[model samples]
Target: MREKIRSGGNAGRVFVLVAVCCAAAAMPLTFTGPAVALPSIGRTLGGSPLALNWVTNAFMLTFGSTLMAAGALADTYGRKRMFLGGLAAFGLFSLGLAFASDIVWFDILRALQGVGAAAAFSGAMASLAQEFEEGERLRAFSVVGASFGVGLAFGPIASGLVVEAFGWPAIFLLVVALAALALVLGAVFLRETRDPNAAGLDWKGAATFTLALAFLTYGILQMPDVGWTDPFVLAVLVAAVVFFFAFYRIERSVARPMLDLSLFRYPRFVGVQLLAAAPAYGFVVLLILLPVRFIGIEGMSEIAGGRMMIALSAPLLVLPIAAGLLTRWFAPAVICGTGLLLSAAGLAWLSQFPVGSQPELLVWPLLLVGIGISLPWGLMDGLAVSVVPKERAGMATGIFSTTRVAGEGVALAVVTALLSAFTQMNLGPAAGEHAAGAAQRLGTGNVAAAGSMVPSMARAAMLQAYNDAFSALLWLLSAITAATAVVVFLYLGKSADVIDGAAGEPGPLRTTVMDP
Candidate 1:
């Protein structure tokens, strides 16, 4: 029987850990669902596109940068303590957003929300890695994956329902409520875990790492607005590169580093890291483009667009479980490889849909993409953790979490930049000069504003621009993802078990539990 911790024992502990971790993972993404309303929010608040872009990047930036530090502290102090604190912080910031009046203040609070998620996700996953072992550990991650799927599926639906009932602020209120629930559960049942040999805090390393990531992300986010060669963007990008170099050197010299630089030497570890980031980059495109495709081109309401997103989200609930169980027999390559191929195929096919295709036409392709992504979802998380010693769970998960979220942030910026470029190219100079605002409006499916932005341009021309941009976006993502699948399949080195650590030479696959 699964034992409950305190009242619930170990089973209860695991349950809460999974629940809390998945909620943390899924909650920020649920915020993405509100992107359906971003154009409206921008117009209503009189915010510029650049300022509104911050609204999205802010959460990703803080969440990704803070993860490693949060992991280090959780390892040094106690995972449970860090988690409770993070949950508290996340809930508070989410509450604060409900009161935010301006774009700047909203972005600031969103960053704080990312910070909280960093702590909560890293701490919660590390705690699970510590508390569970062998089969149970895999089982726990499977449940965690499933929860993520469900939560992702639910985000848009919930956003639609809540936004329909109240306003966008109500969405933050729901986040606050969910965060509070997680906090209560975590406080009551989570079992504390930390590295027994946890070393001193790496304050300098943490600062440098955070700054490097923040600047790197900032530069990337600024690209579309300021153009890539703009002096300010160039300077920040240069600083990001320098800071990253400093971070690498500091990590190498430290007696006990926040991040062990040697981890990259392992082929599987490297592959896992890439795998962590690649899918995330592609997924972020969907988050940015879908609401626009459904609402902007098709002239659907935000609620209808959200409901249609369920087509993409629902399969997440099942496919992860299927992939997890399939791992009992097949290698990660066969599972993840096949899934990636399918995902790429789905994306390529989806890209071909007519510009003004009905939401009903998207269901099959969305399902394909969802299932394809789900196949590799949990397997990767488990593999990354297994490759490290239990004591370094926080660090391992920290790296994984950072790459995934940071990839999302950078991906959004890159994809948005690409979308903007393609749209501009298709619009041509005459219409293109005036297309930016119209394109942005079109993306969110706000046809009224889009029409207003380019009254002289034909609605057909605007729709064509969005279609070309989206087609380019999806085709590019599919090719890249398919290529990544090839790399991961080959580099994973033909094994069901790729958990061999850095202390040993890479060897054959084995099902035995990995050692510290």
Candidate 2:
């Protein structure tokens, strides 16, 4: 029976999703341990704080930029085939990181790893789309969303233990092992999902999109370090706009395109896209900011901070299951709207956290935040994909994925800049003296003076940075969510509406694809 064959296909799809997701799970883990040990790393490697910042930014920029191209590639090649190839590349690059000799090499390898990650995730999603019916899709999206939270939760703890015990090299060694295993599982089980005969590959549109993303991302990253008015930044920004315009032009004219630019004509699609960006920005920045807060401000050890951070993970794991179940009884918008409100509340609650607050005391906010984050993410993604045609699923998914990553990328840069600028503004003359003292201590090789000076100004600067950063992010989340609510009411339209070109109900409500 067709139903039986579809069900059988679902099982293979779910297995592939898990395998590819496992590779995605490996990414943040590679950074977590190193991030926790940043100060120690700087001391050991003779790098400046600025240089160390690249460790995270490089990976994010590359990951965010290449996703669209990878999606195009998956749409062209068979999704399963592309996915397995990506996993192989991912494993290889991750292994390369294990042997990196310096900070530059480490950062380079991390970027390459991100490239492989983009390929794997995009291809995996493509395969998933072909495997499951619309009714089961939300659950699959939930699993994917939850995997990110799980990875974030586990990576730091795992990385901390390894880094503290055997140093940063051990972290990548673990990645190598995970990558190798993923390759084996992926090749053994995954099946091709894309129909090669269905559509022509839009290489020109894809190239333009890639260059646009790269330019835009690099420009944003430079904003933090070089300031926005710098000629190079201006040049890149202009080039990005040009390329993005060119992309639109190409997509509009092409017979078969990578992205269906007309999708933006739907206000619901636009709303979800913007709404999706906000929470992503909030969470990714939170992941980076919180650990620093726990360790630097609250005086928790790196290991202790990593463990306490697990509180955020618990709800992430559970909320997706709750969302999946609720789909049977509730509408996606209702669930998504509620999730947005919860996320806003959680973030606002987190804003109340005073400097040096205990992690245990903030558990409620974490719970709200986790639930808030999980619900809208899964629902929004489901809603967005449901609106698009199956043939254009890769492009739809890519655009959505790009928005999510771009939001996070820009958010991190903006938040970091704001945090840095705000902290410096509030540093009150003492910062200069503190920096001088630290410099002298380092100059004279007196780690004690450096340590002592590090107490007052360093601690205060850090506290101020975390405080401003979290508060700004909270407000940003609120505004973005409120805007999303407006978009939903205005453009997302009546509940249970049918997407054009799809055989479905005539309301906003749509079913998701799931594993058998």
Candidate 3:
């Protein structure tokens, strides 16, 4: 009976699994394309710094805010139900983008699309957890991770081709089609799964967290346009701080909180979450800033710009599989920390290369980053879920995924602000103000506008400004990665002979070198 109950290898089940992977890969379809299309989108909508950024930020903000709530709902109701519903809503929202005549409507539609993605992301993770057994589950997730890498590797090229052929809105239209197919296939093939013992929804905690995320993101996004001291930005920042504190308090007080406040007490769990979120932050800056240098500043085609991304995403496919096997020998701390060190090394090396340098020059470093991110990708998630009780898989998955996407949002805004501020600092105040606006546009990957805005200054100055921005971003991420590596090392210091003395078990690391 147990074997029969656990069996999920039917044709429908297999198809549904693949479909879910495809859907997850497709979710980020719009994330990269917008980097290429933002200039065009801005042309149609008017290129204020805020308008340009909101195109991406709108989706990220809503997606980050709603992910945990969606995960909690999946546990309470049905993973399959929420998964399918998310697909439907996301598809509808994507379709709506085709008719967006103004930037306001575009932002609104993008935000709604994020809501759909949150449901899809959390539900798919929980649904997969429900379907697979121990060893097989790892394989399933690896395939899913590979699918995402494939999508990212191809995204810039695909979006470039589509945007160049049609227009910017066509990108959303294409996503709508992809979402619709996933929706139909999922509805037919996937079965419902939910926690029978769920304590129920925690609306107050949800509201508090959501407000905190929104306000914080808003403040970060505004920092580029309005310096950090603007009264409105300060007020919003204070509110965000208050909401975060309130969220922690509410979760602690509530009988059924959306987030598990106790989970943070686990050093392993928090370390894993940071590991998961850190790469996302690094990747966003890479994706947004690097491509703009290629397409916008260097005058390359979108296809060429996207192809440049391949060097970064391709290693993701092979290294993760190797990393899985490596878990047997290396402690999670050693392996994950090494990955971070390598990633930081790569960024630091790449930061020194001149702007418009050959892609060949960039490939080795990019590959290192790809390898680095892959190392702890699946390993961290496995560790995170293991620390929690089995029935709360949905909650665990949601928390992990939320941290990943939310970190991407905050980092994107931070990188944008930092890039713009640094450019102004180097360029001088009177002319720097104009250069600052151009620098802001470049952060969105709008090379043409940035180039056009240079006040009769040589293009060399703009290129230098861009190089300075890129160097700042690289240095910042490198510092963060190096710091994270130290922390992760301390937390997961034990990896040998910790799991029932089993040779290859994947759980909490407890083999401290100091004890020996």
Candidate 4:
């Protein structure tokens, strides 16, 4: 009986890991797949540029903002309960997204899908902590990371093929199927786990933080269309600041805060957060922008564009695992910093290519960026909890994931706006007052629409303007990435040794090398 029980437990654990890994892959698949389908969606639904951007932004904003709250709820309730609930919600929302006839409906459904994703992801991660022990836990998390990489590696090409053969709706339908499978596995095999001493959810802190992020994203996304000095834009931006201040105050005051403000006091903790955000500017933005540039602007077929994207994402399949192995001989900080620096070089190299440059010419730079970012991507989850005490690992994980996703959403908005602004500037006096409108259209990959708006500008001239703006954007991103790399390296100095000594055992650097 004892042996039988042990065997059954092992079987259950395997199923749990499989379920969580499925959820992990589904998350990135949802993120990157829709990106590839963006042009198709826009063409089918006939939305304005801003509306189209919302399809991606809405999902990211809700997902990033609600993650901490979802984690808290998962702990207070049962992890299994939250995981199952999240999966159901996600599947339902995905179905709605598939059938959405208008862009507005699609954006709304997308936001709902993000909320579901946040809950499912938080629950899935929290459940892993319960199902596995120290060494086994590390391996479990690494498997999850690899699963995420698989999604990123193939999402674009898979999405392109699906969109071409079926339609954009098929992309969301695929997510629904994945979600359903995970949902069933989780419901049957996952154990119910909760924090026995968990405090109730911090509703106020969650609200304030969500509001702050929402307002900030909204203001930034609107900036290009309404201009910097527009009254409503100014109001929303100010509101964002106010809400952020409120969030800080609330977190400090609350007995059980969603995010512990005191964590920022630790230099290593701060460094981890910065590192979490670095990839957003350095790599994540490209996932979206490159697809638009390749298929929408450059007129590459969907399959051709997806194939090009493989160069940017394929390295993730192996580089993350390779980075994990290298950590045995190198400090996590050195590895992470070096990765960002490498990515910066790739960005700069990529900027040299013209808009219509040959696909082969662009491959090396894109591959370099992929390889560089994969190093940090693999270790960020481990580093997040490592920078804090073991007792605080759950909080630290929530904070890091939130930072990473929120940072991506904000980076996408900022880069897109900057690109539009730069394009307008590069248009010279020829486009005149219509420059902003034309730039907006061009930024969304609606080159023909932009030409229609700016009748004075030739197609060739518009493309040149966009190309110059893209180059400027890449250079700016490279500088920012390099600077961030230096700061992350400095802040994480010798802290790994300190953490290990304090714990009186192998710290996260030694044990949790690749937790995604």
Give the best candidate by TM-score.
4
Q: Rate the local accuracy (lDDT) of all candidates.
A: 0.73, 0.65, 0.76, 0.87
lDDT of 2 by residue, 224-314 (tens): 4565488999999999999999998998998876677787865567766866686765466767667666654455666786776676656
Segments of candidate 3 deviating more than 4 angstroms? 1-9, 388-394, 430-435, 447-456, 494-516
Q: Give the least accurate 10-residue stretch of model 2, judged by summed lDDT.
A: 503-512
Instruction: Give candidate 1's error at residue 99 in angstroms.
Output: 2.0
Models, CA RMSD each: 4.6, 5.8, 6.3, 3.8
Candidate 4 shows a clash count of: 0
Best by lDDT: 4
Clashing pairs in 3: 494-510, 494-511
> TM-score ranking from best to worst?
4, 3, 1, 2
Measured with C-alpha atoms, the lDDT of residue 63 in candidate 4 is: 95
Writing each residue's lDDT as its tens digit, candidate 4 over 185-210 gives 88777767777667879998999999
lDDT of 1 at 369: 84
Task: Name model 1 segments beyond 4 Å from true.
Answer: 1-22, 25-30, 130-134, 387-394, 436-453, 494-516
Task: Tell me the lDDT of model 2 at 69.
Answer: 74
By lDDT, the better pick of 1 and 2 is 1
Query: Which wins on lDDT, candidate 2 or candidate 4?
Result: 4
